[model samples]
Structures are given as C-alpha cells and as structure tokens.
Target chain A: MRYFLELAYRGTHYHGWQRQPNGISVQEVLENALSTILREPTALVGSGRTDTGVHAGQQFAHFDTDLTLPDTLIRSLNGMTPSDIAVYDCFPVAPDDHARFTATYRYYQYQLCRRKDPFRADLAYQFVFPLDVPRMNEAAALLLKHTDFESFSKVKTDVKTFNCRIDVAYWEQHPNGDLTFHVRADRFLRGMVRALVGTLLAVGQGRLSVADFGSIIDARDRKRAGRAAPAEGLSLVGVGYPDSVFTQRTTGPAQAF
Target chain B: MRYFLELAYRGTHYHGWQRQPNGISVQEVLENALSTILREPTALVGSGRTDTGVHAGQQFAHFDTDLTLPDTLIRSLNGMTPSDIAVYDCFPVAPDDHARFTATYRYYQYQLCRRKDPFRADLAYQFVFPLDVPRMNEAAALLLKHTDFESFSKVKTDVKTFNCRIDVAYWEQHPNGDLTFHVRADRFLRGMVRALVGTLLAVGQGRLSVADFGSIIDARDRKRAGRAAPAEGLSLVGVGYPDSVFTQRTTGPAQAF
Candidate 1:
C-alpha cells in the first residue's frame, strides 16, 4: 500500500531533503523511524528537495509498505523522530499518486530581518539597510510576467527546462518591519527562489532599477542575476495537489493500539 | 561609571544565565565578547539568573568600566557575540542603580504547545492533552491575592523570603490554540514560575480544582504543589527598573567606526 505523510521540519541540521553521504538528512532520519515502526524497510519520496538550513512549513512524502499500519502511527512516528521533524498526518493515497510529479504548485517564502532579532537569528537573513519596498514590489511584479527563469536558476542544474509560470511574487512587510518575499509557481528550478530574492533585494537597495531587473530576465543567463540568498532565510511553505489525490483516505482514526 | 546593557538570548546551548564551572553560560559568553571588544577584562551582573534551557527576551546587566565607551559598542558587541545572544542597547546608569536589587518587577511567559510544532521544538513545551484555559485563569487569578509563594518555590534556596507581589497571572490562548501563561510580579522565588505553571496545568487538566490550587498556596509548603514544569517552556520575557536608571543615557548613536 502507498501512504502519504504530511510533515514539517526545521532543516538547520539536515543536508537538504535528499539522501547524502557526508551529512545527515531529514529523509534519512524519517525513513529510519518509519522503517523501525513498520518493521519493514520503507523508502520515502518527498514532494521536493530543500537545501541545507532551509525550513519546510509543509511537505508531503509517500511511502510503500506491505503490512497493516497501526492507528497510532502518527503519534509513534512523532515520538521516535527527532524534535526538529514532525509528522502531522498519514493516509493512503492512490498508488499512482506521486508526491512530486502530481503537485500542482509550490509556494516559498524568504524572510529578511530589518533589525537584528536574536530570536530570529537562524530563521531570517539580517539586512539592516533601508529598503525601498514600493520599488521592490514593482520589480517583483516583473517575475509573474516572465516564464523563462534561466537567469535566476542555478547554473548546471539537471532540469530539462528553466521555464516556470510564476503565479504570485511580491514582498510584504511584517508588523515588525521585516520583509517576506512570497512566490508561488507551477514549479521552481533549483536555487530559483533564493536567486530571485537576492535580485529583488538589490532592487530594493537601489543597486538595481526595475528596468535593469527586467533586462536581466531577458538575458537568460544565471550570471545576470544577483547572488542566491542564504538558505536559512528560505522555507518551503506550501505544496498543492489535486483533490483527487486525497479522495482515498485510508488511515484509521487515531487511537492507541 | 556603571552602564546597563539590555540584551536577549536563546538559551538552548548555554548552561544558564549564571557562570558555572561545568558548562558554558550566557553571562560568560557575553563577558568574553565585551572584554574582547573593550580590550579590558569586564564583569557583568545580570538582573537575575535564568535556569538552563530557559530563554530571555529581555534582560539587563550592569558592568563597571572606566574607559570611554565607543559609539558603535552595540553594533560591535552584536557582531562579536554568538548568534544566540544579542546586546540591544548600552547606556550609563546611576552608580547606585543595580541590575538585581533595584529592579521593580519581572515578567515571565510559559509557552505550552497544543500540538507538536517543528519550528518551536526547543522553544516551547509540548503538551497535547486538552486543557481548560478558563479554569486555569481562575486559578491564576488567585495568585495575585497571595503574597507567600513557598509552595511554588524550590525547597532548598537561599532566598530571604518567598513572598511575591504577583500583579498579573493569566493563561491566554492564541489563535492556533497554544496557551501562554503570562505572569508579572515584584519578585520570583527560585523555580517559582515553573512550579506555578505545573500546578496551574494541573488545574487546567481538572486534576486539581481552583480551590485546591488556592489551598496549595495557603499551605506554604513546596510538597503541596505539582511537579515543576520543564525549563524549555519558561522565558524571562521582561525586567523592569526605575526611570531614573536610564536618565543618564551615555551610549552614543550607532555608527560605523
């Protein structure tokens, strides 16, 4: 049976979402915990990969198992896994319903602290310079008009295409005067969101004009974009899937076995 | 001259606010950072000590120094100190003004998570069981009527008195259903906040009635209270001092040296 897991993780300690040899990854720890609880070797496929020090407010994963799952799986999984990761829900999905390929959209947020906040030191990028929020928003609107994001993508990525339909892109000022860049798209290329944030920040700082930002997209070269923002300030905030994917919920009610 | 340093810290890595031989502490780290930046050995006396794993949103400390201080001291101190600790402001105070003894009140907050939150793993205490917030507030209101909090204090402490003037004590439920216990008092006994939270939690859970809680305080014995809540949930959120303490603001405006 195939089951989908809804989870979240603080990615400060993980080497992204994928399994890697050098450092521990969220996928590795989660797989180990699931396998132990299920008493079977379980492998998980995540909705997408998040780089080191990036956080995920919501993420989905799919795993296959042959045994009848316990009703207390969620509670047990939470208890067994480290505190940085939390498994919120688990339910059977259609065997063909893929965690990655079937997702319709992804939303990401990049947080920039206007002041040095000790509580948010690890969670936000500290940028104390005065910013032109109105000007930044003007440049951000340019993102939704462009489909070829090669200029904002990491160089040498394996993806076949750099085209993405950006649905929303804007900078919102929080009550605390911090800024958060909200971007939603059909799909994002590796390092695309951070690169976009970095470039937008340049515009906000008056280092780059709105016309200059538009020209950079037309250039279609990664070198034309600004540096990728730090990973700690970026988070995978949301993932969208078709309603049919969750129509076949099969997990039992939560109860102690 | 005596200067007061306003600071904050995330205490996950430190032993506590006090210097200890066994482990690192916030005070030790701050002192080292100050000593290095000022080019002289310095000592700091904090408003009060926070236990290991307890966070502080706002704390004040006094240090005596003879040399002229730099205008960029706040910025420089922040740059040199660890990310977990931050010095917000520094200004000379009346020589008689003390960080601990001259303080007017202290405010603390205890965060209880209604559900497991990956982002707040180390910042809050997770208690998934259902709670009665109104009942808990009723019990909390009784705190203001009493002066002696011996039942909610650590058994073995060198404090001259256990009497506290609790001005505010209540449980507020956030939009997400998490409960925060906010308490303000003239002074707190050792382990007083955590012990009060634990006993209040018992009231919230219906294990102890509001009348029973009042009786516990009247008993004036530590054994009558519930177990002390974990340190992670408690934070020294605010410290109050007389207005005259800041009348001699001596720190210059923040500027790059």
Candidate 2:
C-alpha cells in the first residue's frame, strides 16, 4: 500500500529537504521517526527539495509499506519528530501517484521586511532602502509572458529544460509596509524563484528598468540576472495534485497534537 | 545624564528579563552590550520584568552615563547584541525619569492559535479545542470593572499592593482564525496576565461562566483562578510614558543595520 503524508517544517535547523552526508536534513528526520513508529525501516520521497534555511508551509511525501498501518500513526510520528517539523496527515494514495512528478503546480512566496523586526529576523529578508513597488510589479508581470526562464535559473542545474509555464507572478505590499512576492507556475527550475525576486528587487531599487528586465529574460543567460536572494526569506507555500490519486480523503486538519 | 533605550526581544532564548543567578537573561545581554560599546561598566534598569519564554514587542530601559554619547552608539550596540534582541532608539531623558516608575500605561497581548502551525510552534499557544470568543470577551470585560487582582497574582511577590487600574481588556479574532487577548493597564501583578488568560480560556471552553469568572476576581484569593497560561503566548507589546521625559528626540526608524 502507498500512503501520502502531509507535513510542514521550519527549515532553519536542517540542511535542506534532501538527505545529505554532511548535515541533517528534514527527510532524514521524518524517515527516522516513521521507521521508529512503524518498527520497520521506512523510506519516503519528498515532493521537492527546498534549500537550506527555507521553510515549507505545505509539503507532501509518499511511502510504501507492507504492514498494516496503525491507527495512532500520526500521533506517534508527531511525538517522535522534533518541534520544528510536524506531520499533519497520512492517507492512502494510488500506487502510481508520485509526490514529485504528479504535482501540477507549485506556489512560492518571498518575504521582504521594510523595517527591522526582531520577531521576523530569521523569516524575512531586511531591505531598508525605499522600493518602487509599482515599478517592481510591472517587471513581475513580464514573468508571466516568458516561457523559457534560463536566465533566472541556476547555472549548474541538472534539469533537462529551463521552460516553465508561469501562471501568476506579482508583488503585494502588506499593510505593515512589508512586501511579499507571490509566484505560481507549472514547474520551477533550480534557484528560479529567488533569482526572480532578486532581479525584481533590482527593478524596485531603480537599479534596473522594466525594459532591462525584459531584455535579460530574452538573453537566456543566467549571468544576466541578479544574485539569488537569501534562502531564509523563501518558502514553499503550496502544491497542487490531482484528485484521482486519492482513494479516500482521511486526513484531519493541519494541527499539532 | 540618563538615557532611555527602546528595544524589542524574542525571549525564547533568555531566562527572563531580569538578571538571574543561573541562566542568561535579556538584562544581562543588554548590560554586556552597553558595557562593551561604552568601554565602561554600565548597568541599566528595565521598565518591567517578563517571565522566561515570553516576548516583548516594545520595551524601554534607562541607564546613566557620564561619558559623552557616541554618534554610532545604536549601530555599535546592535552589532554587539544577538539577532534575537534589537535596539531601536537611544535618547537622553530627564535625570529623574525612571523606566518603571514613570510609565503611565502598559499594553500586553496573548496569542492563541486555533490550529497547529509549524511556523509559530514556539511563538503561540496552540489550543485545538473550540473556543467561544464572544463569551471570552464578556468575561474579559468583567476585568475592567474590578480594581483588585489578587486572585490572579502570584502568591509570593515583593509588591505591596495588588490593585491595578485596567483601562482596556478585550479578545479579538484575527482573519487567520487566531485569537488575541489585548489588555492595557496602569500596572500588572506578577503572573496576572497569564492567570487571567487561563481562566478566561476556561470560560471560552464552557468550563466556566462569565459570572464564575467575575466571582474568581471578587474572591481575592490566588487559588480561585485557573492555572497560569504558558509564558510563550504572552508579549509586552507597548509602554506609554509622559512627554516631558525627552530632551531631544534623535532616533531613526526602527531598522537593523
């Protein structure tokens, strides 16, 4: 049987979403907790990888097991996991449903703090300079018109193509004077979201014009883009999956015990 | 001359606001930072003390210094302090101005999470059970009618009186479905806010009626109230002082260098 686990994590303590030899990762911790609760060696695959210090508001993982699952699995797993990580739900899914490949869309957010906030020091990027938000929005609209994002992708990524269908991309100024960049797309290349935010910030700072931003996208070279924004300010906010994958919706609300 | 420093801190890492014999405290950190920057042994007094694991959005402290004030003191102090603590302003005040005695009002907020949130694991108190906000507010209004809070105060305290002038007390529900208890008063008893919140939560959960809450206050006994709510959910959000204290306001916008 295949099961899908819904979870969220504050990524400050982990190396990233994927397992690594040098430092602990969210995947390793989740796997250990699941294995301990089930009394068997369990391995699961995450929906995608998030960089170090990046948070995930919603993430999915899938695991295969032969033993009958316990009714107290969720509670037991939560007890075994650290406070920074939480498992909200566990439900059966079709054997063919893949956590990574079956997802239809991904949504991400980048937080920018206009003022120095001690509470959000680790959760947002502080940029005190005055920003031209309307001008930044005009440049962000240029994202939806482009299909190939090679210029905004990491240079050494292993993906086969740099083409991504962007559905939504805009910057919203919050009432507290902070800024949040909301972007949704069919898929994303390595380091794409942060790169886009960095470039848009340049536009907001009047360092680059809308025409210059569009020309950089047309250039199709990663070197033409600005530096990648810090990982702490980025979060994987949501992911979309098909309804056919679920045999039955048995998960509860996203709350910790 | 005496100077007033406006600051904020995330109290998860500190023992409490006051210096302790065993653990690190916010007061100790600030004093050390001041001593390092001024190159003299400097000791400051805080507006009030916050329990361990509590947060402060805005706090004030007054320190006496004989040496000429440095222009880069704010930046230097921030550099010496950790990321969780922030100093927003430092200005000369009247020599007689005291951080604790002269303040006219103090405002506090207690956060309650309706659902389990991974991002706010340490910042809010999670109560999955249903709550009656209107009922809680009604119980809170009873607070403003009373002057003595001995029933909600810690038994062993150095204070001579338990009477507090409550200006405002109310519970507000945010759009995200979280509840916040806002209270402002001329003074507060040790553990008073948490005790009030815990007992009011009982009213919200139907465990106690509004009249029962009032009777708890009228009893004037410490054992009559519910257990004090956990410290993590509470924050000292604001403090009000008279306008006569400032010699010259020379503070910039609150932003970390």
Candidate 3:
C-alpha cells in the first residue's frame, strides 16, 4: 500500500531533504525511523528537496509498506521523530498517487526581516536596509507571466527542464517589518525561488530595473540573473494538486493544531 | 591602558557569552581571536554572563593592554572578531571603571510567537495558542510596582539578592503574531526573565489569575513560580551605564573589516 505523509521540520540540523552519504538528511532519518517502526525496509520519496538551512511550512512524502499500521500512523511517527521534525498527518493513498509528479502546483514563502532583531538572527534573513515592497511585487508579478525560468536556474543542476508556470507571485507585509514573498508554480527549477528573490531584491533596492527583469527572463541565460539569496529565508508553504487527483485528500483540522 | 568595548553578538551558535569548558563560548572565541590579532594575552571582563543560546543586543566588556593600538579601535576589534561577534564602538576608560558594577540598568526582551511561520524555529520560541496580551501586560505592570520577584526567580542560584527596580515592563505586539516582553531593571537574577515570561504566559493562558500575580511576586519563593520559558525566546536588548562613565571615554567610528 502507498501512503502519503504530511511533514514539517526545522532544516537547520539536517543536511537537506535529500539523502546524502556524508551528512544526515531528513529523508534518511525518516526512512530509518519508519523502517524500525514498521519492521520492514522502506523507500520514501519527498515532494521536493530543500537545501540546507531551508525550512518547510508544509512538506509531503510518500512510501510503500506491506505491514499493516494503525489508523493513527501520524501519532506513532510524531512520537518517534526528533523534536525538530514532526509528522502532522499520514494516510493510505491510491496505489498510483505520486507525491511529486501528481502535484499541480507548489507554493513557497521567503521571509525577510529589515531590522537587526537578535531573535531573528538564525531564522529569518536579516537585511538592514529598507525595502520597496511595491516594486518587488511588480517584479514578482512579471515572474508569474513567464514560463521559462532558465535565468533563475542553477547552472550546475542536473534537472531536465527549466519551465514552470507561476500561478501566484506577490509580496505581503507583516506588521513586524517582515516581508514575505509568496510564489506558487506548477513546478520550480533547482535554485529557482532563491534566485528570483535575489533578482527581485535587486529591483527592490533599485539596482535592477523592473523592465530589465523581464529581459532577464526572456534571455533564458543563467549568467544574466543575480545570485541566489541565502537558503534560510525560503520555505515550502503548500502543495496543490488537481482536484481529480486529490479527490479524497484533505488536510486534518487546522483549527489550532 | 584600560579599554571598554561595546559589542553585539548573535549567540545561537555560542555556548554562552562567558568562557565554558563544555564547548566553544563567545568570550573564549573572542579572546582567542583578539589575542591572535594583538599577539598579547587578553583577559577581558564582561558586564554579565549570558547563558547558552542567549543573544546580546548591547554588551560591554573591559580589557587592559600594555601596548598601544590604533585609535580606530572598533576597526581593529572587528578585524579580529568573527562574523557572529561584532565590535561596534570601543574607547579608553578609567582604570576603575567596571562593566558590571557601573551599569545603571539592564534591559531584556522575551519574545513569544503564537504560530510557527517556518521562519522562527531557531530564533523564537513558537507557542501554538494565542496569548491574551492585555492581560499579560496588566500582570507585567504589577511586576514593576513591586521589588521582590521571588516568584520569577530561578531556584538554587548564587545571587546576593532578589531585589530589583523595574524601570519598564510591557508586552508589545509586533504584528507578526509575536509578543515582545520588554523589561528594564537595575539588574536581573539568573534566569529571571525566562521565569517571568513563564509566569506571565501562565496568566495569559488562564492558568494564573492576573489579580493574583502580585501576590506571587511578594511570595518570593521559587516554588511559587512557573517553569522557565525556553532560552531561545530571551535576549539581552540593552545595558545602561552611568552617563559620566561614557563622558570621558572617546571611541572611533564603527567600520567592520
């Protein structure tokens, strides 16, 4: 049977979501813990790979197991996982359900603090200078109108495609002087969100004109883009799937949990 | 010559502001770094000891040196200190000046987050439920009206006294659904702010009556206090000294190398 796990974690301690030989990854730890609990070898695939120090508001992964587990699968996983990692929900899925490919869109949020608050030192990326949120939103809106994101793609990545349809792109201000950039797309290229944030920040700081941002996307040249922002500010917020594919899928009660 | 250094540091990676044997400390690292740069043995005395994972928004320390360094002391110190530790302003002070004793007051901020934003995992302690800010403020107001804070004092601590005059006590909402408890006092006992936040949180959660909070302060017994909040939510925001101390002290501009 196939099962989907809704998860979230503080990525500061792990190497990333993908498995690696040298450092501990979230995937490896979850797989090891699940194998012990189910008493069977299991292979799990995450919906996305978050870089080291990148967080996730909501992340999903799927695995297959022959053992019959209790209905409260999430409770057992939550009890076994480290305090930094939490499993919020788990349920059996259709045998063909895919956590990654079947998703229609994935959303991400990048949090930025404009002041030097000591409490946000390790969490939100602290940028001392003032920001132009309106200009940033304009640049982000232009991003949603484009499809080929080659300029924002990491040059050395092994991904086969650089195309993505961004359905939503905008910036919202929190009362605490934090600016959150929300961007949702059918898919994202490797390092795409971070790179876009870097370019948008350039526009926000008046370094790059919004008109120039459009050409950068049209150029589809990685060298034309600005450097990627640090990973600490990025987070996977939500994932959306086609209604047909996710007919029975529903989030558990979000009323304070 | 005797010198006093005004510095700020993000203490997330540090064991504490003081030298420690368990792991690398902020003071030890600064000592080693400054010693290596100046090629002299330096033993600096700080205003106070900040516990592990506790940040210093404004910290002061004094060091004596037999050799004469450049007048641009901030530049020299910044060149020596790590990125996590920053030296802002430095000046020559009277040999009798004491960082801890000469201080008139010390201010601390305890932050409480109502929700997990994926951006505050390391920087702020995430409290799930909403807190009644106005009630907590009323209880905190009672704290400033009293001198004995035994209910907010940590147990089994080596302190000469638990008496303190709170100059300011208030909790302000930062619009990010996080509350900041700002308190200014002549001095704070060990774990005082965390303990105070614990009790105030209890009041906010309906665990303790707001009217009864005053009696808890008068009780002065550690057993009457609530559990200390996590260290991540606490930060030393400011340290105030007599104006006369900084009057004669001349320092150079802040220029980080």
Considering just chain B, what TM-score does every model have?
0.95, 0.97, 0.92
- The per-model lDDT (C-alpha) reads 0.89, 0.89, 0.80
What is the per-residue lDDT of model 2 for residues B3-115, given as tens digits with 9 covering 90 to 100?
A: 99999998899998999999999999999989988899999899999999999988999999999989988878877888788888999998889999999998999999875
Q: Between 1 and 3, whose DockQ is larger?
A: 1
Instruction: Give the per-residue lDDT of model 2 (tens digit) for A73-180.
Output: 887887788878878889988888999999999899999987567787778898879999999999999988999999998889888889999999999998678999
Residue-level lDDT for B38 in candidate 3? 69
lDDT of 1 at B14: 88
Q: Is the docking of candidate 1 incorrect, acceptable, medium or high quality?
A: medium
Please report the candidate that would top TM-score against the real structure.
Answer: 1
DockQ winner, 2 or 3:
2
Flag the better candidate by TM-score, 1 or 2: 1
TM-score of predicted structure 1? 0.94
The CAPRI class of candidate 2 is acceptable
Candidate 3 residue lDDT tens string, A1-257 = 88888788778788889999899998998998888788888888889888888877778899988788877666677667776787767877888889898787888888897644444444567775767888888888898688899999988988788889998999899865678888999999988999999999999999998898999999999899998988878888787765654455566522111
lDDT of 3 by residue, B80-148 (tens): 666567776677788888888888888888777664433444556778676788999999999778887
- Fnat of each candidate: 0.68, 0.60, 0.05
Scored against the true structure, residue B40 in model 1 reaches a CA lDDT of 96
